[model samples]
Target: MDFREYQRRARETDQTPDTDGDGLIVPLLGMAGEVGTLLADYKKRLRDRDTYRLFKESIAEELGDILWYVANLATKLDLDLDDIAAFNLRKTRERWLHVGEKQGRLPFYLLFDEQFPPEEQLPRKFSVKFSQEKQGSGATVVLTWDGQTIGNRLTDNAYVDDGYRFHDVFHLSYAALLGWSPVTRKLMQRKRKSNPKVDEVEDGGRAGVTEEGISAYVFSYAKDHSFLRNVGALDYELLRTIKRLTASFEVNIRSPADWERAILAGYQVWRKMRESEGGTVHLDLVNRTIAYSSE
Candidate 1:
């Protein structure tokens, strides 16, 4: 039967549908128990090996119980199962599709500075040179573009050199992969001053700080995962947190797949830059890539 019909019939048997805090626990606990039971049944089948004669039917029965509890909980909360299923599919589709892997459709990319003058927009292509200098016991990264020094020298500022000094690569990746970076706008003098509201809200200090927060947040996650070395996919909840963080800005239009690419590419360049002590990072917006050049 269809999900809607099954949902409607499922609730008919839900005796505890009071919609109160305590009443909600019935279905919630039921779902958890059924999941546990399903796994336990599988364990028994594996233990019994070929002697597990009714394994298929037993597993199906447990799944039906789980589905009933899930439907009953949704009904209690006044939700439609079919709508929920559709929404979940949409979310997973957007999250799983790789940046360059779509078969027939190009991923949507938004460039917030499209209407602005050339100088006022991020350079479609440019190279930022990072030169590391020694300061007694610490190191500082001098950032330069077009033979002119841009931002101040960066140091880890931590008790140990944890590579936080290379975090700026994350911002550069956002500029290259997602075409949005408040920090880049401020550094390159590309803020949307022609529109005061956009300047204040989109390319302002708070937005720059928000970008930095994302860089720091993702860095922490990367550190525990070997700096994302040889990793293929990112944690879904981590990407969801980034969405909530940037929901107020234009960059929010970028999908989780875009953010994942940005984060991974940034870390890849950062690793090379760190190993080489310093290097020139090339950003190509037209191709959506960031590459490190030791030369």
Candidate 2:
């Protein structure tokens, strides 16, 4: 099954809305406890030089629980597991190796003059592949942060920190790709100023535009912008649809701490605008105007 089907099924049965307020935390913690117990057993078995059958079985079961909780958390966050997995792989590649470079640096081995290992020779990582032969044919989503690379292995501590960093990076990158209004950002500033603890202040009357006015102004500016017009020239219909989307007055963004939230909401608006007319064609992040992107 494709991602949509996986998500639909996860929503229907696999996830529970346990209202203790911790959501997936409780389940995840329980899984962690199980892993801890398995690790203890494995240590004892290794020390005694005894058969480790029970230890391996216990470890496998706890890991399965951890995977389930991870999927549950991803669903609650409105993220696709496969997309997260793929993005992680791409990021790992980028961080450790240059795109065109043959030999890349692992945490330990620095092989600047050698070629990258063939797939078979490369160290095995936690592979997540959508198995066509699985019951539902779900796409494989592998994890390989702990796997050895070249001659060095990523430490557990480093792996966890890197994962969270990648998650934050994804959030920021996605926000930049979607265009959010400047006025919404200003409202966020208003929220910061109104707080008693925040002493740094800007002049009054800033970030005061109504949602309707901003939307209209944005549409008008986009329609008149010379660069946008030329880039969107091939598809005049796209320009027309964007104009209509901005015509709606149902703005979702309301405050400053809501900057990331607002970007997501704006993307939703843009999605509907595309779907209402037909397919989501003729969309480009290049036309977006963001100050940081000036470089």
Candidate 3:
């Protein structure tokens, strides 16, 4: 079905009456939880080599639930899922294809130690981290014991010399939605010039604009849309917080040592906010080839 159809079904499933004691945050958070769960399940099936049709179907079903709730939340807030989707597609295009001198793209470094050798072996812990001190922020990823890190391959010529980071778009989008000053945009423009491939560039594609162009446009358009004013106003704090976090993460992409410190600190903050409820912790930074564990 189309985007609106997905949203309509989502609202039918997740939303309650205007006075049924349900608000926006509850369902959004629920959706986030389900997405995490679905991801976990998908990994399990992949590790077990249980890639049967039924397993795939089950994973897809759970993913649908996640998407439904996400749509419901967006609809409730008068947000456009299509717009978000479009923007995200553009960002992905830029990051994977257009950004920087391809060589600047982050390097992939997979590990296959005896403890967490491969999917065939009993799982220990596997993680991937991507960071850039030049961009000022980084991420630390932690995997479950059943996870394996493999095939850190680069198929594109663009990921060669320098390091590139694209998360500033999060802050830029958030800032635009709130009618914040254009400082973020100016910064982004500078960042794009310096790293060429990360920022949205004009191109033609399936739709009128290239998918990335649409993302860049929606980011500006959504802010100007009158119906979104209320929703944007309400989400001001969340956006602002995201912008700050993005800025904080992007500040450490300079050197490996610097990236390591910045990424760990950011990961700690992220764990506190996003994954603190869970017990197991394993964050591995690929470029640095270091793993941090907490039990």
Candidate 4:
């Protein structure tokens, strides 16, 4: 049966009244409670091997309860279950299929359709440099990219002794792909004044963090592809640090191959948003420049 038809029939069984704004609340609570019951059943199955006999049946029943609450909630929100399902599938397909096909290819080739240029063919080497200055009881760390000062962080003796560093070149590549550079951010800010909602749907709500996460994924891919080595010897901590920092974002970074797939996935997401919402930023790695456009 069609999902809409199922939703219609399901709505018929929703006897909850609209009184006291409890219609949504009822289903929301039901969903939470049903999920808890489902978890409990799984826990029991894990604890008791004999429970495996009934686990499938129990799971099916709990899932049905969860579906009922979901349908009810959709009804309360005036949303169609079929529409939600369709939208989710469309989003996933758009963001994965094309990019997934490009796995195993060099990132520059996958992203810009150009071969990975030899080091001598490139204009200049990319590097993130750091300097330290002694303060009262500590030192302030200053970071620079291509001789342009970028950021500063105050650090204690121990922190400086640790020789920690931040990698920005990989992130620059990601920012170039997603148009999340300082210039892009400024443009977005200006656009927000005229159309506040533009920023809401574009850039995934947190462009900086999103770029960092994608960049980390690409860094992993680059490392395995030998792109990092091609450029120069890199600090072993670069990928480790990026992975640690972006872990909070819940990005999947299982293996080198997975990271390449993830980069494509991330590119598709930002590309779709840009195509629909109207903004463009292209990175010219050779010239080390970013060109921006907006509609």
Best-performing candidate as measured by lDDT: 1
Which of candidates 2 and 3 reaches a greater lDDT? 3
Per-residue accuracy of model 4 over 89-199 as CA lDDT, tens digit each:
864553344443356432333222123233212222243343556667554555444456655452533533322222333344343332223323332222233334433
Segments of candidate 3 deviating more than 4 angstroms:
15-21, 51-53, 99-295
lDDT of 1 by residue, 173-252 (tens): 99999998999888777888888999999999999999999998998899899999998889999999999999999988
- Give me the overall lDDT of model 2: 0.35
Q: Write the per-residue lDDT of candidate 3 for residues 121-219, one digit (tens) a residue.
A: 212223322221222233332222334432222121233421112222222222222211123324222222333332223111221122223233333
Model 4 weakest 10-residue run by lDDT = 111-120
Q: What tens digits encode model 2's per-residue C-alpha lDDT throughout 1-295? A: 7645665665665545564457667656766776787778778788866555576677777676666666666776667888988887754453333333245421222211113223211121121111011123221111122332111111212322111111111222222333332232232221233333321221122212333343443334433543132231223343334334434321221112122222333334333322232111122223221111100
Q: Largest TM-score belongs to which candidate?
A: 1
TM-score of each: 0.92, 0.30, 0.32, 0.45
Give candidate 3's whole-model lDDT.
0.38
- Residue 197: error of model 1 in Å? 1.6
The count of residue-pair clashes in candidate 1 stands at: 0
Query: On a 0 to 100 scale, what is the lDDT of residue 170 in model 1?
Result: 87
